[model samples]
Target: MSRILIVDDEPHLRLLYETELRRAGFETMTASNAVQGLEFVETMEPDLVILDIRMAGMDGIEAMQHIMERDQRVPVILNTAFSSYKDNYLTWAADAYLTKSSDVTELVETVKQVLEKQATAHG
Candidate 1:
């Protein structure tokens, strides 16, 4: 099973994503902020990351830069409540980008697609 690290400031989102991803047969980990998420990226070495653009301390864009520097191979999915971030060029570094919604079906599908694409690229 693929391990996914979900980085978001919202506690509810973290739990929601974790529950849904687990149901999708994935191993999930949650980090409340970009700082913790970065640590998980280095220590846990998750197969994929679902990152939120806006957080308390370091934003996801900066965090994504650090994550890529540490390991470019790990794919990141930018999940944000604000669609405006998509216009920013920095977000392009992520493997996938999606606006947040109450329904998690899109999130789950995107996760599978990103993971599959990463697997293909690595192989």
Candidate 2:
């Protein structure tokens, strides 16, 4: 099973993602903020990370820089509600970018597809 790290400021968002990803057959870990997310990644070394860009402390972009430094192969999916910042967000390196309102089916399919691509590239 593929392991995934989900990071969001909202506890409910993490819970929703955890449940949905679990149903999709992925082992999931949840973190309420980027700091915890980074620590979890250090220990678990998940195959992918789904992150929210508007965190309070260390935002997703900053945290992602650290994550990439440690594990460049670990794909990241950046989700943001602010559509206006799309250009700014794209400057950050991410394997994928998803809007927070994206359909659940699309989210699931995208994650799976990214995981498959990551597997192939690393294999």
Candidate 3:
């Protein structure tokens, strides 16, 4: 099973994502902030990372930079409430950028697509 790390400041959002992704058959990990998320990247080495752009401290853009520096192969999805970050070059480091929504259909589809692409490339 593919492991995905979800980094978001909102506890409810994290829980929602975790429940949905798990139901989709993904092994999920949760981190409340970028710092913890990065640590998970180093230790857990998740297949993909779902990140929120706006957080308490190190934002998703910054986290993407650090994550890429560590392992460019790991695909990151910049899941944010704001779409303006899409214009920022820093966010380009991520494989995908998604606007947050209460409905997680898009999020689930994107995760499947990215993970499939990764598997194909590495296969």
Candidate 4:
């Protein structure tokens, strides 16, 4: 099964995402903050990561950078509540970026697109 790691500081966000991804037939994992996220990347070995850009300590950009260093091929999708952050996401190695207000269907589609595209390239 395809695996996904969701990193969000908001408890509800994590739960909602986890539930949604699970219902979509993806094996899901969660990390509440970037610190915990790094650990999950090392241990959970998720095929894709849905990361929140605005976090307490290590933001999504920094987390994406670190994750890239560990596994350059894995796709990391960055999401943020603030529109301003969208402009700066290109500098990071994140595979994709979308606003939090984006519809759940869009989010799911984006994730599938990214992973399928990556898998095609990798395979």
Model 1: worst 10 consecutive residues (lDDT sum): 65-74
Order of all candidates by lDDT, from best down to worst? 1, 3, 4, 2
* Candidate 1, 17-115: lDDT as tens digits: 999999999999999999999999989999999999999899999999898887357889999999999899999989999999999999999999998
RMSD of each: 0.9, 1.5, 1.0, 1.5
Candidate 3: tens digits of C-alpha lDDT, residues 1-123: 999999999999999999999999999999999999999998999999999999998998888888888745689999998988889888887889999988899999999999999989989
**TM-scores for every predicted model:** 0.97, 0.92, 0.96, 0.93
Off by over 4 Å in 2: 89-92
What candidate 4 gets wrong by more than 4 Å, as runs, is 89-92
TM-score ranking from best candidate downward: 1, 3, 4, 2
Q: What is candidate 3's TM-score against the reference?
A: 0.96
Better of 3 and 4 by TM-score: 3
lDDT of 4 by residue, 48-104 (tens): 999998899988888888888873567899877877876674535677888886367
Q: Which ten residues in a row are the worst by lDDT in model 4?
A: 86-95
Comparing 2 and 4 on TM-score, the stronger one:
4
* Deviation (Å) of 121 in candidate 2: 0.8
By the TM-score metric, which is better: model 1 or model 2? 1
Error of 4 at 102 (Å): 6.4
Per-candidate clash tally = 0, 0, 0, 0
- Looking at model 2, residue 18 earns an lDDT score of 85
lDDT value, residue 118 of candidate 3: 92
Best by TM-score: 1
Model 3 residue 70 CA deviation in Å: 1.6
